[model samples]
Target: MATPRLFVKGTVLGYKRTRTIQRPSSTLLQLEGVNVKEDTGFYLGKRVCYVYKVGRESRCIWGRITRAHGNSGVVRARFQHNLPPQSFGATVRVHLFPSSI
Candidate 1:
């Protein structure tokens, strides 16, 4: 049974950060069912979007998956506009575009 979905679900763990610094331009994410480092390879260069509700309207923040974040299947996303702090722990949609699939 094939579905009509065109994207995958991703979680915004947080922004790329260090012990004393954080870079909002680089956001960290984890895609559903992608639990291995090698599995993340296919997602590289793909686009990602964070959707949020604003009163009765909706908004989105677009980004691209730069590379695998670590050995635990985490991925790093770079956006033109830095994701707001409120996006932390938010659900993002990973699109299989750029025809890389």
Candidate 2:
């Protein structure tokens, strides 16, 4: 038998860079239908992927949820490469990997 894989849908809000300094940045993701701060904990440390097409081929960028952002349920994610500005409002998949099972 095969094990089931889990994935949650989320949207990219933007980067975590501050004004006057943009050396380091983190992506912000908002899980679909998840609007409570407490619920964000469930996704911490989970794998996340943002897939986009460069042309006819699709490419994927992976990341992990670092922590919860604020009281509004947004979560912070650190990707191998910083997500582009065009990815804002784009959808991403949060994989339930690195499981404890």
Candidate 3:
């Protein structure tokens, strides 16, 4: 039997660095119930998706968790394209795939 995949819900907390930095930064995401640095490692390399609607059409930007950020259980994800400002405070999905199984 095939194993079921799990999708963890995360919130887009904005970019990786402070506003004054002025350089490009990876998107920051905080997973639900993940509030510690230790828990972030398990999610490294996991796939992330930001789904939104553009008029009648739905679109999604895919990314992967590249590394853990800070001690607050936040993660840094690099997407194929930079996410828009509207993505902040929005929800994203983290999928458990590319499994070791």
Query: How are the candidates ranked when ordered by TM-score, highest leading?
Result: 1, 3, 2
Q: Identify the superior model by lDDT, candidate 2 or candidate 3.
A: 3
With candidate 2 superimposed using the best TM-score fit, by how many Å does residue 15's alpha carbon deviate from the native? 0.8
Clashing pairs in 1: none
Error of 2 at 92 (Å): 0.3
Return the TM-score for candidate 2, rounded to 2 decimals.
0.85
- lDDT for each residue of candidate 2 in 8-69, tens digit (9 for 90 to 100): 89999988767765533688889987798998887889999999998899999999999998
- Show the lowest summed lDDT stretch of 10 residues, model 1: 92-101
Which residue pairs overlap in candidate 2's backbone? none
For model 1, the superposed segments whose C-alpha errors exceed 4 Å read none
Q: Mind giving the per-residue lDDT tens digits that candidate 1 earns over 1-101?
A: 98777899999998888999998889999899999999999899999988889999998878899999889999999987898898888899999766654
Query: Which ranges in model 2 have alpha carbons more than 4 Å from their true place?
Result: 1-5, 19-24
At residue 37, candidate 1 shows an lDDT of: 99
- Measure candidate 2: CA RMSD: 2.6
- How many steric overlaps does candidate 1 have? 0
**Sort by lDDT, best first: what order?**
1, 3, 2
Model 3 lDDT on a 0 to 1 scale:
0.89
Candidate No. with top TM-score: 1
